[model samples]
Target: MRPFDPRLVRELPQTRAPVAALGLLGAAAGVAAIGQAFAIAWLVTALVGGGSLWAPAVTVATILAVRGILSATTEVTATWAGARVAGVLRERILGRWSRATADDRPAPERMLTISTHGASSVEPYVARYLPALVAAAVVPPLAIVTLLVVDWSSALIVVATVPLLPVFAALIGRHTQEATQRRWATQTRLAGHFLDVMRGLPTLVSYGRAEKQADQVAAVGDRHRIATVRTLKIAFLSSAALELLATISVAIVAVWTGMRLAWGNLDLQVALTAILLAPEAYWPIRRVGQEFHAAADGAEAIDALLADVPPACFAGRESMSVRDLSYRYPGANVDVLQGISYAVRPGLTVVTGPSGCGKTTLLELLAGLRTPTAGAAEVPRTHLVTQTPFVLPATVADNLALGTGASPAQIAAACAATGLDRVIAGLPDGTATLLGDNGFGLSAGQRARLGLTRAMLSDAAVVLLDEPTAHLDPASARQVRSVIRDLARTRPVVAVTHDPELAALADAQWPLTERVPA
Candidate 1:
């Protein structure tokens, strides 16, 4: 991996200013540090030569104070940069998923890991490693130039030794990067498995397979643990090796300067300054090496988050039309749908099929939530209500107004149309009532109505629903069916359902059959 990715600034322009600020601060700090070294050397020389010490003392004190303030500011800037970059990347990642077709996204669990854990890992990379990298770039060269001005022999020694740190760091970093990648993959797998177990816990328990799932989770956890330890081991070893190399390089410079001073070839002040500045040339590089290990996981996450995800393809048309549309899943050998043709019209169109006849997939395609493998679909702006509509934790009014920008009056009207207004009225806070995660405390019918109400608020030209009336009682089903029929009167409505009553209410019916072998 590169020490720093330029794409970070290109992809997230908001971070550019903060990153530039960091570079400036790092440069300023380097200047201050070098000044402190010179000031200390002057103070030592003044005391030894019986010269006035007040000026040198004050210079040392002032430079040290400036360095302290710069240190604090660097911390603050690094923190802000970390948060800003991580948050922006997370938002972009989620926004990409929101607009992409189903096939273009990663698995649910993998996406969950990326948006949360993966993006979060970038914080340390931005906060600590970046500043260290800047320091390594700005400080060492400045120190070497100063050394060259004072004593060319010392400067040559530093220049000769400085290259060794990065070369050794690169060799160790190769193994470190590999170890970190393995650990990251193992971590992703563990996170995916744990999420799967949680989602399927109820089913697993019912089938007496919960213990098996527990064992599987434990096994994955163990593998992740081992990978983590191995990565950390490499990180620790690399840090030690870099530190040892830096110490040895600095010691060599110090030894040469000491011999020059003893032989009366180098002045005492020059020797002291050389001793001080030699470490400056090596420590920043060491810091970068240490920070790189801490930021390795973040580097991997950045690569994944920036990977290309194809956008959904939908052509604008006057009306929705499917012409010989066919789709086969990514890895499937046979098509779930083939040679399907239809043009949606201004009425309810019920699509009926067996359990595995791609009925749900058909609605997804029409809604531009999936791309067809063969042929084309001309889809207009659409609102798709899946079998279990998404309901995040929020106020009733907020959930209803999500993405629609509907006013209070408009939201009330949409709720009334779907009979959700009654449900809202019975709540303690009415529209302001806060719902739990996944619309907890609301029944299936109520959640369904909430989804339909949202659809009612939308200005979509087409409405697609999956299993709208499934798992509802007779009274709730009647209310839902009435709302759906009322919606159909205004624009085109397509629903995938097994309900005979809903199918009977359709103005047209499209029945699908299982695909026969070619």
Candidate 2:
């Protein structure tokens, strides 16, 4: 795993399109604003010089209408672009999650924060702040240059005070980033603790510790609330301070402009334009500061998730081999098995062991779910079947296909191999039977058999089974073992089981027991 950084949060499909559109929109908006300023100056001159007002009035109306249309178009485009970026980001996150290890899965609360609050927090910034930021950069400079041509003093005032907004924004941004990071950490912790407590509710109740656990949850919630309030306070203060600075700067520029007008150093039209445009210069900086705070939380969560993604290991030889392989759980002092070696030729081998003797762990090692802590293990291609099968919410045929795009006939053959053909025939929809929510409607045995069928459908060189028959009745268990035996005749099968009958049927068997290391 490498350190997480925001740069790695895959680029969105709409990134380039939105950026280009925003640039064009900003240019158009700047032009429109300058035209509006020029129109205002002309209208003022027309009224004062005792000329016809109708021309200036019509010009003002035209500029306003054009500006309005451009603004609306920019807004709509920004909204669509932001939504598309968000969708891309979500898909990338889920894709990375699927490739991550079991241990890499964030605590339930952290997952919720990322999926819900973190995602929502970034929306406005992407859609509104980004495009507005581009416009601000362009419009302010053009407006200030127009003022400079009319009166240098007003332009100087606007220029000198404008930099203060960004300076203040930088300082505030630093503080906000720190505060947001802390707030995000606390939020994830609170969520994780709540989920952990909920998951252990039965145990807590059994031991008469439910009240104690409730107090702990309350304490965690209180801490999270405090952190949230602190973050909000900092965010609000930063926004207010930036707004005040911009406002004061604009006011000072306006007052200076008014004095120049009174002294006849500048005309009324130029003074009015400068005053109207002063705030526009600082608007973008202030908006960016506000949006930075909103995006900070999501960035922090993404950082945490990305930091744990494991680096890809080199795929060497095509076939897998095992030599004196062993593993131990993290922080454990002893290996579960000692100096175990095996070669899985293209056929069935069953591993029989007592409870807590590392049968499932062995299957995981063979399936590439975990690497050996000592020695080496090799696998060409493999699929695994656990006691509790995971059934995705899809058609029965899809479940068997396992995203491999296997044909209907192939799926049927796999199902038949696992003795599920009769089960499918009995269903009203046959292969199209909907497996809802982890296959809840199906019995445990049915789910297990379906899982076995899916593994068969995978067409891997090796199939690893971890107690595939544990949930079945005697008749069904025997039938499944017979099917497995038949399949093993063609390709290698490595099964971990406690069933003596299954072990006896294996061409070769390995019994795992606690023993001294070699």
Evaluated with lDDT, which candidate comes out highest? 1
The C-alpha TM-scores of every prediction are: 0.98, 0.87
Residues 271-300, model 1: lDDT tens digits: 999889989999999999998888988888
Reference-based TM-score, model 1? 0.98
What overall lDDT goes with each candidate model? 0.90, 0.76
How well does model 2 score by local distance difference test? 0.76
Q: Candidate 2, clashing residue pairs?
A: 109-191, 320-378, 320-379, 320-380, 321-378, 346-492, 347-492
Each model's Cα RMSD: 1.3, 3.7
Residue 190 error, candidate 2, Å: 2.5
**Candidate 1 lDDT score at position 408:** 89
